[model samples]
Target: MITRRGFMKVLGGGLVSAVALGSYAFGIEPLARLRVARYALTPPGWSPGLKLRLVALADVHACEPWMSARRIASICERANDLGGDVTVLLGDYASGMNLVTRYVHSSEWSKALATLRAPLGVHAIMGNHDWWEDRTAQKSGGGDTFGHRALAGVGIQVYGNRAVRLEKSGFPFWLAGLEDQLALLPGRKWKRAWMGGLDDLDGTLAQVTDEAPVILLAHEPDIFPKVPSRVALTLSGHTHGGQVRFAGHSPVVPSRFGDRYAYGHIVEGDRNLIVSGGLGCSIAPIRFGVPPEIVVVDLG
Candidate 1:
């Protein structure tokens, strides 16, 4: 029923659109685009008197030609300019993809991150890539990953299943960080029915001594369901907004919950979670609708 000329025109249009999309996803969005996503919320149980602004950066999978040290420093500069009361690094400082001209070393990336500044100081937590990329930590199954040491070396406090009490203008709150939930990879030497995780949500929450509202920093959003009402807000970055999202849906989320916690602000039963789209690629160098971002959360 179709004419040859009409069919050829349709095919040509399709090819052109595909080429444009490919260029934007693989080159423009991944390499050039950086955005600051701002969110303001007053979570239930949060003190009316206390106001906090948090700048969060995550998944800086640093590597050559993509996330170089220079690029990271630029990002840090922008983050510092935001004038947040606190800054949090949500992890995955190591290069996650193998298509790098050269791997940016921990020292290089950490040095760049050292430029980040906040009145309450910069705090960090490790992500799965930070754990899985370290051969020494992976083999031993229970030691500080290279990413952890590098962050510490730069004077950034890295929390591992720990809670810290912090105050802003005489209002106190608790900040808790859980270890990576996907620390150990499966291998012949160590076989497990379930992927090993180092996170201790129960133990970490137990450390919070008082009723001061708690803000939990988890690398992956998979821990959201278990998060109790005790936590005012949960911040995470690991799914990378499924790396290619459209119409508020990410088709291939890395999470066990599928698209439920794929990205952005999600509220459920008085509990709140904000997942960052993050700054770098994961398994592949591609980004589409979900461009790299630095998330700014304003909580009261």
Candidate 2:
């Protein structure tokens, strides 16, 4: 049997540890540690003279208590300071989870986004949460342009199942962005479904020249499997790096392929996929081991 003094000591230690952990989760983890995940990719054509710098920010849920307008602006400013040739914003503009949705006007978030600048340009693509958030707002007679219009308002051109050539003076490469796979679904629920009908990969790729290496922007990494080998690299962010990776394992990743494509760089043959840990949280406003990050990919 344990003595009264021993029990009291144990209880005090547990309480202190709990408080410390809670502080880290609610404060330190979510707000701090903006990491720059840099990668160097050598495309098919070996050109030592040409280099491209692409910066990606994913899942910026942009809701209160964690993601505020000032914080968004700061993120943009910091990203600009990184001196990326081109910046890509992977969506999740308005925040929500499960059946509960929170409304933060797109203009508020857009105001901060206008600050982002890159020489090649700032491009964007929608995530499942962006689609769900807009649909949720539409049910209440709000506008359906929260994600799309907001980015466009800030001089960011949004690509939906389309391809564009980078205007930089170098070995030309194509950037293709797919429409949100959940766009066809009728409701706010996000699940793995056969999205072949919704995505027009052939049409998107039609614009690209054969010689150029293709870099695809997709919200969910689950789409990586179907992506052809023609695409040299695919950039994505939707799982939030499992949002709670522990001991190098994330217990609750929303991937059908398990941890294979859950987060970070995944290489299959010559094709590659890089999944960002993302900038904000969903469902719960707390994060454990995974911190928000900006991914910088250097391709030549």
Pick the TM-score winner.
Answer: 1
The superposed Cα distance between candidate 1 and the true structure at residue 156, in angstroms, equals: 0.5
lDDT of 2 by residue, 212-279 (tens): 77889988888887888888888999889988888767888877877777788888877788999999
Consecutive 10-residue window with the lowest summed lDDT within model 2 = 188-197
Candidate 1: residue pairs that collide = none
Model 1 stretches with alpha carbons more than 4 Å out: 190-194
Model 2 stretches astray by more than 4 angstroms: 1-4, 43-48, 97-103, 136-144, 186-197
Overall lDDT per candidate, in order of appearance: 0.95, 0.79
Measured against the true structure, the TM-scores of the candidates, in listed sequence, are: 0.98, 0.88
